[model samples]
Target chain A: MKGVTVLQSGGSNQMELADLSVPESGQDDLLIKVHSAAVNRTDIMTREGKAGYAVNPILGVEVAGTVVEAAGSGSFSAGDRVMGLVNGGGYAEYAVMPANRAMKIPDSISSAEAAAIPEVFLTAYQTLFWIGKLQKQEAVLIHAGASGVGTAAIQLAKQLSDAKVIVTAGSRRKLDFCRELGADILINYKEQSFDEEVLKATDGRGTDLILDFIGADYWDKNLASIKHEGRWVLIGVLGGSELSKVNLMPIMSKYIQLTGTLLTPRSDSYKAELSKDFAEVVTPYLEQGKIRPVVDSTFPVEKVHEAHQHMEDNQNIGKIILNIASAEA
Target chain B: MKGVTVLQSGGSNQMELADLSVPESGQDDLLIKVHSAAVNRTDIMTREGKAGYAVNPILGVEVAGTVVEAAGSGSFSAGDRVMGLVNGGGYAEYAVMPANRAMKIPDSISSAEAAAIPEVFLTAYQTLFWIGKLQKQEAVLIHAGASGVGTAAIQLAKQLSDAKVIVTAGSRRKLDFCRELGADILINYKEQSFDEEVLKATDGRGTDLILDFIGADYWDKNLASIKHEGRWVLIGVLGGSELSKVNLMPIMSKYIQLTGTLLTPRSDSYKAELSKDFAEVVTPYLEQGKIRPVVDSTFPVEKVHEAHQHMEDNQNIGKIILNIASAEA
Candidate 1:
């Protein structure tokens, strides 16, 4: 199997394409012949040696592929098209994961599109419904409106409930993209304070839920923009990690809830449960063309380095995918 | 009617007993002839002019009394013994509150005993069941074990679920009281780090739920002592609220949730609903004598100042009550 291996260079991550043995499939696992994989910010950090990774690390976290082999009594069969989140070993010709983590993709969705679904969609679905508990007619504020998870969260919040979805992006182009995806209010965070804008948009009541990626920079603002009994779900700390002497008085007064979560590092059973629930709820919407993938661009597997660069540059509006298989499959 | 009034002296609170007119009962209200009232820490703050209160503040929050007048079509009749949480005016000879806020007290309970039930028990019930969602076989850590809310939480957590209850208190006596109320592990926080003790008690996995009233002082330690997906419910900031540049990385990695709540300042309907729920779940335990009030001492209404001083000095083990009516009555 041909795959990308991370090499350390003066404490920096360097990627190399090399030949490696195929990973083994365990009982109750499916051996997937990966067709497409996606590049995420975490991948860039892992590659740069900033985020921790194991020895002989495989870089990709999400894959859309076909099951080449299935353990008996598994939910999937050989040759079934699937998309899923893998703990690791995704940026390769084949990857093996527990059968429950994989979801069958409909023929209507392309492999590249399916590859974009797993991490972003699952994270969005879990954050809004499972973590945020977004109710109908409640409002949600999603930061980084143009990012993969943010875009997916906006669409999910819109389609799943009658929620007023607000978004904050750095550019007008990203704001416009978010508007097309059903964002009710788009604030150019670079030009204006999102907290003030959110207050204005919601008539001073503030948002019922917030999806935050920028931690330290938005910590106080996020607190200020949340309504009574609202939830502030922290997904990423892109800006920084240290929060300075935060007064929890408002939290008590407003009865706010702050929770932090990640999709990776979860148990196989936990991932499987969320995956099953997501497939049941979102599959019909995907098949009916109500919700679709937002693939920013695609790169050949040989161009894996460039895929990491693309996400690092923060230019992509949605998922940046790596085409593992040849164009003709 | 006679009621306690807060006098401001050099920006500090001074208590005085004064003559006042009885409060009016609305169409859906109950006019209670007060028998006994409980002194909570919040009352001390409101009395000291530390916690914000409205003009002409009345101190008491919880009370047991007889229904002197029930508005037409209300739930209670004249002379019915009841106990409830009043937003204010519990210090007066008569207090008027909505009918639903008051619950009929059983004959097995004394007026002072019933007076101790509303605020602390309701807070404990709401925190453990409603916020923490404590399940069977889970573990809970209740800080300030001998305090009114802590004592109630210890009892409720033990009676409601088969949970292993751990407590952190300042003294041997407090720890003993907690143990009698069914604490599996007791850590004298004054002698050692609760986080380390909690880890040891839970075999390094940590507690599933934490009922915290001590804020900033226990903030980091509380984070360290929680298990994966554990909930830390904050009710007060007795220790302090100034948390300096705290790192939120652990919250993300452990998938922890931190929520802040207060029983006061809630809408009438919301409080009524929770009151109803508490009555439904804990009434059986109360009837079976599985749960009982831990009243520390009683002070006549004229000696209300001493009651406040007792709670302020943290000298009481459980709830301190003010007997408003004659002992024979």
Candidate 2:
């Protein structure tokens, strides 16, 4: 099998394409001949040696392909199309995951699109509904609006609820792109502060829920930008980690809730519950033409390094994917 | 016309039951002839002037009374036996308030007991269900177990859901009292660390919800003691307010939620909603004999200064009530 491996940590100079033996699948696992995979911030972090004892300690978590071999006890037969999530080990020609984690790809959606769904869509769905409890006619603010999670969140917010979805991007081009794709209010952070803009747009009441990625630096502003009894969920902390002394007087005054979550490391049962929740909440919207994953760019599997570089630079307007070799019959 | 007034901040030395004129009721107002009142930790804080501006900025919020006057536009009328929350005027013969802040007190419950419910019960109810989203069979940890809020929370947890209730108090005697009240586990913080005891009780899973008062000092411990996806609600800062730095990584690693709430500053619509929620969810439990407010002691209205001092000395198990002059009708 051909795959990308993280040789060591440090910069974008680490990932290498190499030949490796395909491993056998367990009785409950599906051996997938991966057709495509997606690049994410986690991949960049993993490339920089941040897996932190993840079982596989490889890289990549999103994949779409045909099952070349199903462990005899599995439900899917050979040649069945599927896409699945993993803690890592998806940046390969063939990967094995628990059958339960692999879902049959819809006939209406291509494998490339299917590849994009596992990580971004699940993340957006889990954050908005499972965690933030976003509702109709309420409001939400998504930071990094051009990123995969941001784009998926906006579409999910629009499709699942009649929420007033607002987005923040670093550039007007990205802001305009998100606005056309259903964001109700778009703030270009480079031109104006998102905190000020969100306050202005929400009539100084702040948003009902906020999907935050920029951590500690935004902690104070997040407290300021959320409404009375608002929920602020941080799924990523690209900005920084430690926060300066917080008075907490604001939390009591505004009655704000601050929570942080990561979906990948959660136990299987919890993930299953969240997966069911996501399927029930998002699949119908995807099936009907109510919402769709936005594709920003694609790279051939041989050029997977370029895909990683693009995602590392955070230059995409939506999900950046890698097209692997065609599925084996 | 007479009311309690504060001469200045700092202990009961500043709290005085001085005379003042009663004001007229607005369209949404009620004028109650106070029959009894109570002291809360916040009252102690207000005595020390820590509750800087949440109250009317004129008087503190506390109440127990008869509806001497009502505007007929809100929820009550003249002559109704009432006990409700107010920001600052309950230690008086007359108190004016928005009608919705008052709840009907059943004849089965005394004025003193009724006076004790508003601040603590409401706080616990709002924090546990509305914010924490605590569910049946989920484990909950209540700090200061014999304190008014702790006692009420223990009863509410036992009555409302089958969740395992755990508590921590300053003394073994206090822990014993909470244990007899159905707390599954009790930790005497004076002798043993609560987080370790909590871990022992929960089989190393930690608490699903934690109600904390001592801030900064207990910040790290609360984060460690809470389970994955658990909620930590901070209602007070008795130990201290300033933390040198906020270790946010722990929150993300544990997927914990941090929230702060102030009951006094809530709007009429919000409080009314909360009041209605209490009436619907909690009042029935009270009526069914499943839960009841715990009144530790009472003092005559003229001895409010004494009541304040008693609370200052931490002399109550549950709530301390201030009774007005007896009437022959």
Candidate 3:
């Protein structure tokens, strides 16, 4: 099987497409023929040698594909459509996924869109609902609003929950896109101070929750922009990781909560729970057209580097996809 | 009316047993004849010229008293026993307390014990349950194990939830006292590293939640000791307010929460809700003999200076109370 792998040789790891033996299904797994895969900063950071990611060299965390074989007895079978979290093998043509992680893809949605939904939507779901405990009439501020998870958070927080969605982006173009995704307030972070804008927008009450990607620079601002007993959920640190001089007095003084999480590397049990939650609470919104995956760009699987480069440059406003199949296939 | 007042006439504040006009109660307030009072670190901080306290010349936060005059239309009568949180006036012989913050004292409890219940217990309850979201079977790490709030938290965490309780104290004696108060794990922070102790106790899974008062000193250790997706609820910052570095990477990496709070300055409406929660959930535990207030010593009301000195010297194992009357009455 032709697979996308980052060879673990020397100083820094980089990807190399090679022919490796396709993975076999575990007792409760699904052997999937990959249709599409999406890019994440986790892939980049793992490639950069920060974390000890899954030993396998494949760089993708999200995928959609056809279940060519079922591990044990389950609803999915040969030719049955599915989408879910994948191992490092997501960038490959064939990958074995935990059956519990895979949810049946709705017939109406395309494979590329389905692939984009899992990682970003699940991250947004976990941050907004599980960690933030967002309630009706509350408000949320999504930093890096143009990114996949940020865009997904905007849609989910706005459509699914009654939260007033505020988004911050580097450019007006991305701001406009986030506005289209139902952002109640948009801030061009490059031109304006997001802290002041957020405070102004909230009438100094601050948002109920903040979804942050830029870590230290935005940490205090997020704190300042949070309402009393508010939540600050961190899923990524694009700007930098060194959060020097964290003054915790503000958080305690206001009864705030600051949480950082990675949906990747979660236990299989937790992944199963997220998959079920997605199928029950989120998928209907997608199927009914109330919410949809936001795809920024698509590239053939061979151009995975370009997709990564595109996302790394901070140019993409949504999920970047790798088309595993030929254009006409 | 004779009252215990701390006067901030200049750079330094002085505690004085002075005469002041008696307070009149509103429709929803009670004229409490102060029988006992408990001093908190907040009062000490205010007396020592710390900024941001709500009221001036106020000495105490928790009060236990008889209803000498029932100006309100509530349950308390002229001779009914009660205790409640105060906005600052608990040091006086007579004070006007919000009816909601006052609760009937159990027959088994004394005025000193009742006085000790409001500030420390409520702070512990609010941080552990409401903010930290501590649940049954989880693990909690509390700093300052011998302090009033710390001992209260240990007892409550053990009694209310099935969580494993861990505490860090300055000495072996204090650590032993915390163990006596139902702490599952005790760390003498002076003898060894509390972080290492926490890791050792939890099988390296770290704690599910942390109740922290040592602000800047325990910042990184708190980050290191909490499990993934855990919460760190802050109530006070005795060590210092400003941290030299605010590294948010660990916060994001482990999904930990860092927040601090001041319970006394909270609005009346919010306090009412907290009082309701205490009445429903915590009050029953007290009556059921599962939890009790830890009182260190009681001093005469005229000895406000001595009580403040005891708290400042950090000599109390639990709460220090001011007694309005002796055994002779």
Best by DockQ: 1
For each prediction, how big is the interface RMSD? 0.8, 1.2, 1.8
Task: List the candidates' TM-scores in order.
Answer: 0.96, 0.89, 0.94
Q: Candidate 1 chain B: worst 10 consecutive residues by lDDT?
A: B7-16
Task: Point to the candidate with the largest lDDT.
Answer: 1
Comparison by DockQ, 2 against 3, better one: 3
Local accuracy of candidate 3 as per-residue lDDT tens digits, B114-188: 998988888898888877788997999999999999999999899889789999888888988998889998888
Show the colliding residue pairs in model 1: none
DockQ of 3: 0.71
By DockQ, the better pick of 1 and 3 is 1
User: What are the chain B TM-scores of all models?
Assistant: 0.96, 0.93, 0.95
| Tens digit per residue, CA lDDT, model 2, B86-134 | 7577677777767776788877887888888888898888878887788
Residue B214, model 2, lDDT:
77
Which portions of model 1 show Cα errors greater than 4 Å?
A: A9-13, A53-56, A327-329, B9-13, B53-56, B326-329
Candidate 1 CAPRI-style tier: high
Tens digit of per-residue lDDT, candidate 1, span B10-110: 22137777778888888888999999999887777676666675333677888899999997835789999999988788888898768887888988999
Where is the poorest 10-residue window by lDDT in model 2 chain B?
B53-62
